[model samples]
Target: MIKESTASAFLFHVDGDGVCRTALVWHPRLEEWLPAGGHIEADEGAAEAAVREVREETGFDAELLPGPSLALPAGFPHTAPVAPWWVVEMDACADNHTREPHRHIDHVFVARVHERGADEGAVHEVRWFTEQEASEAEGLAEDSRLQLKALFAMISDGSLTVAA
Candidate 1:
């Protein structure tokens, strides 16, 4: 099967009540709640795609919280882009037989929503979910649910910061 590159951002924000919440969009084609993300465009890298997807889909300006970078020698002639939290390959259309079978190499990122854009019109209905709410949410993919659980646990342990 052919493989296409994609980027996904798990965008989170801390509510006024000191609760961490993540945004999810209902994917009509997949019939599941998913993060705001899409294919990586030809002109951009995965990190750039992740941020752009979040803005276009959810009308939120997000800053990616990249994983730790390796220390390079001072004379290294390259600059490394922000690293994704995780990467996985999944079937793009597992149940849809009409389309050709393809796989997605998804770069998963964790980001914080800095602020909502002036134009709050999103492509899909956006819903915020607390940890408990997300755990109990129906139509959520198991992989996504596991990621959310880890994110919430990190936040609770002060390992992840959601402050703007």
Candidate 2:
């Protein structure tokens, strides 16, 4: 099992089409390319934390798609996972603070955004970049890139469902 303090990720895809676009947050810590998510906090579920984190960090209010939280099983590296993950996303960032202060049992959720925004909450900025662009971004992990690739495939194949 992954440690509780590990940071989880949640990439929100907005208006995904030919390019398979997504919203990338410039995290101050890693100083690298990453999604709008972090550790899960106390007094909340992982799904709720993901939605709240995306909104607080990206100025986009996301809706966490319902289902079992996507937990990486023991010893299964990111590349070998065959099934798609729990996807969630939004383009409207709700007003909130972005200081993520918690340790957690990491659970990454993949989501597609419903709308595009030029500006929003505490998030310094927002942009629609293709999944390919994200995959090639500096400092991103191969596993993360593969995960995004899988997410795009699911989005393209109509296996992903978005709930308002």
Candidate 3:
């Protein structure tokens, strides 16, 4: 049996004029707007990775509005039940064999910036998308849209607390 794993995180920021915006990285597979995130490095924590990823993808440094915590949307199916022992291992192994899900269990944070600033020279390209723009993106995940809407609402208000 081989054991391997990956962790990721994303950031939500508000651009100038209080327009809640998020940094969406262009994923090669699921080519669409997605929250800024990536795999957690060997020596980095979830939040740290998310902050670094946001900066690397968007060239804007962000502060984690909240710590490493689970931000499941309402009625998230995670708590349903654990699969059987072998099934869990099989699923993990099959998933590993195929491809590592990039957005799996990403540690999410909230941060507000007056602007997106700039884009890092990395291969990753970013866009400041409003909720409507994000929702309109083809193949946009429902969960991601929900999360972005929550962030937009919080940023729209005067506070960017981790209420999402």
Candidate 4:
């Protein structure tokens, strides 16, 4: 039996000038809009992959919000451990391209960017949507919808602030 492949992904919600919106990409296979994320590559950690995936999909550099970390002992390499803010267990079936059905154990993260734009790495068109717009958007993935709610909550609580 094949085990679910581990993946890392993140969504960026930027708030500048009283506007709140999230970055989304069009999924050609699914024929719908989805968040910026993808499979984790070999030789990459979850957190690293999350950051890399977002940059590749959305063309914006992302940094995970800092969290409590263990203190390194004496003589340690002095590297801080980065952990994912959330983990989602989801199954992604075969699309138009891939025939085999499989599941992805997704390591999810959220980030803030000064601006939203596309770059050469963008395979599909990237768009930003407000919380209400995203929630009402047609053809959005169910998982993505749920995650958006949480992101808006963070924004409401002021834990995640959009800088000018």
Candidate 5:
């Protein structure tokens, strides 16, 4: 199958009411709600591409959390995984964006939004949804819901934490 590679970052933040929410972008071509992400540019790693995509799509600086470390023999070497949150292979229609039938190998990362403008409208068209809300939200991709569920589990199990 013809496949394209891309990277995405899930930006999570705690609202004033202390609710955990994630930022999603409306993908016009796909007509679905997705995280801030896009094609990985040349000379970019998956993690780096993810961060850049999030910034471009959401206008928020996102800091990605590291994934698991590599375990190699004393003399052997391996490049550890960069974006540890999630990685998925999914199918997509060739739309105006790509202009050809293709699939996407998505590299997903968990990140926290650092800076947002005072004027909410200034940010790109984005929506913030709580875990429960995301689960029931329409127009959301199945992968998105599954990832959100996993994220909630990670938080509940103390694997992820929001900084004050």
Candidate 6:
């Protein structure tokens, strides 16, 4: 199956109630709630695509949390982009008569929203889900639920900071 590159952002923010929440959208095709993301365009890298998708889908400007950086020697010839928290390849479509089967190589990143904005370009209804709510949300993929749980655990343990 052909594989398409994609970038996904797990955008988190503190709500007025002082609870950390992540944005999710109801995907009609997949019939599940998922992170805001889409295919990486030909002109952009995964990190860039992640940020762009978040803004387009949620109308929020988000900054991706920096991943662990390598200690390169001074003045290295290469520039490193922000790394993703995780990467996985999953089936995008299967056993469909109209569409061919394909897999998506998804680069996942954790980000913090700078401020709230209008949900103008959102293609689907958006909702903010608390960690607990995400974990127990119906119609959520199992992998997504696991990711949410891990994100929440990291935040609680101070391992992953969502502050701007």
Full-model lDDT for every candidate: 0.86, 0.56, 0.55, 0.70, 0.77, 0.85
Given candidate 1, what's the lDDT at residue 123?
A: 82
Ranking of all predicted structures according to lDDT, beginning with the best and ending with the worst: 1, 6, 5, 4, 2, 3
Quote each prediction's TM-score: 0.91, 0.64, 0.63, 0.80, 0.83, 0.90
Query: Best TM-score goes to which candidate?
Result: 1
For residues 1-164, write the lDDT of model 2, one tens digit per residue: 22342233455544534345777676555455566775457766666667777777777766555344466688986643222144423221222323333223355766556666654665634555576676677766455667678766766787765422
**Alpha-carbon error at 55 in model 5, in Å?**
0.7
In model 5, which range of ten residues has the least summed lDDT? 114-123
lDDT of 3 by residue, 121-144 (tens): 645776667668886877565666
Top candidate on lDDT is 1
Judge candidate 4 at residue 66 and give its lDDT: 48
Q: Where does candidate 4 clash, by residue pair?
A: none
**lDDT (10s digit) by residue, model 6, range 1-164:** 78888999898988666789899878878889989889899999999999999888777778998666666689899988889988999987753432687888999998998675567777677888988889888998789899999889999999998866
Q: Report residue 13 deviation for candidate 1 (angstroms).
A: 0.6
lDDT of 4 by residue, 44-149 (tens): 8777877777787777777676433456788987576476666767767874334677667777776667656545577667788888988899988877888788
| The 10-residue segment with the lowest total lDDT in model 4 | 1-10
For each of the candidates, give the backbone clash count.
0, 10, 0, 0, 0, 0
Comparing 4 and 6 on lDDT, the stronger one:
6
The parts of candidate 4 lying over 4 Å away from their true place are 4-8, 13-15, 67-80, 95-99, 117-120, 162-164
Model 1 error, position 69 (Å): 4.1
For residue 150, model 3's alpha carbon misses the true position, in angstroms, by 2.2
Find the 10 residues in a row with the least total lDDT in model 3: 81-90
